[model samples]
Target: MFFAVALLLPAMAAADPLVGVWKTEPDRKNLISHIKITACGDKFCGKILSAYDATGKEVQTPNIGKKLFWDVSSEGSGKYGGGEFWVPLIDVDAVPQMTLQGDTLKVKGCEHVLCAHQTWSRLQS
Candidate 1:
């Protein structure tokens, strides 16, 4: 029926290879989050989808709909850069460079002279 089809449309939607949900590696506090990346005009932007504490339990936070990164420009050879990532835990905006390889995404960010990196996996349907 039309109602059922409409309800299923979102679930059936195919995710773009570069634009989908990603699960971030655990932070220093062992907190993990799900981020959804989407195309914003000619660039890519990401927002926090959900958060999980160290105990693998969902936790509500003020950053639920906050931007994780923005203005991400893609380079050839599966590399992405030229964006700023808002590090929620440390409350800093760092320049982000990302590389996409298969279902794994490698993300590195720098704020001033300090840098950090994390490997994220694509969220499976």
Candidate 2:
């Protein structure tokens, strides 16, 4: 099992193309979160590594280092589906889907039938 799992790690990493740090669009309060998206087996997950105020100054808050979303499965063709994202500001959960194009990612989710969408840019370094 160990050998088989080890052999599959490289393939798993290559399976998902949308793996990297992403800068989320500003929320209603004009705060942006830097989310690190990584591969989790066949799925993907993103966690907040840091946040910035509207002025681009890094802010230290309880939301830092929190899991933004997880279990995002690939739907092929630069699209992913079936993930749950937590909005710390409102303390609400929503089902999320994402579509990636170049360095931009379009994230969409719905909470209680209210849908929200945002565009996140890929972060280098």
Candidate 3:
């Protein structure tokens, strides 16, 4: 039983997808930031490391250290569910489904029920 438990621990730890920095593509200059994700009392959360605007100027948004991800639980298969993201874009709050594929994370939402997507790529450690 002891040996079996040890083997299982590593497998479980490897499943978390939000463990590194992520950069937005096509226009990486606008939003280049790091998301350090960790477990917070049965829930997972992420924080912004550093963010810059389109002109490479650092943004001093109020949510710099805020919890960008929360109430999210890993659903296996490199996917996370039951979470919402608050970005600087939309005025009204929106909740979208999030997925992780290797180092790539994708978020999907609807604008007037029309499909919209945001892509993030993991930053190299």
Q: Evaluated with lDDT, which candidate comes out highest?
A: 2
Residues 4-98, model 1: lDDT tens digits:
88666444323436688999999887889999998775678899999999888999889899999998877868898897999888999999999
Superior by TM-score: candidate 1 or candidate 2: 2
Residue range 1-125, candidate 2, lDDT tens digits: 99999888757754566898999989987889999988887678889999899999999989898888988888879888897988787888899989999899999988988988999999952
Candidates sorted by TM-score, descending order? Answer: 2, 1, 3
Off by over 4 Å in 2: 1-10
lDDT of 1 at 3: 85
* TM-score list, all predictions: 0.83, 0.87, 0.65
**lDDT tens digits, residue span 48-122, model 3:** 776777677777766568666666667777677666655545543345566888778886654356555778888
Local distance difference test scores for all models: 0.86, 0.86, 0.63
Better of 2 and 3 by lDDT: 2
Q: How accurate is candidate 3 locally (lDDT)?
A: 0.63
In candidate 3, residue 68 scores what lDDT? 64
lDDT of 1: 0.86
lDDT of 1 at 87: 87
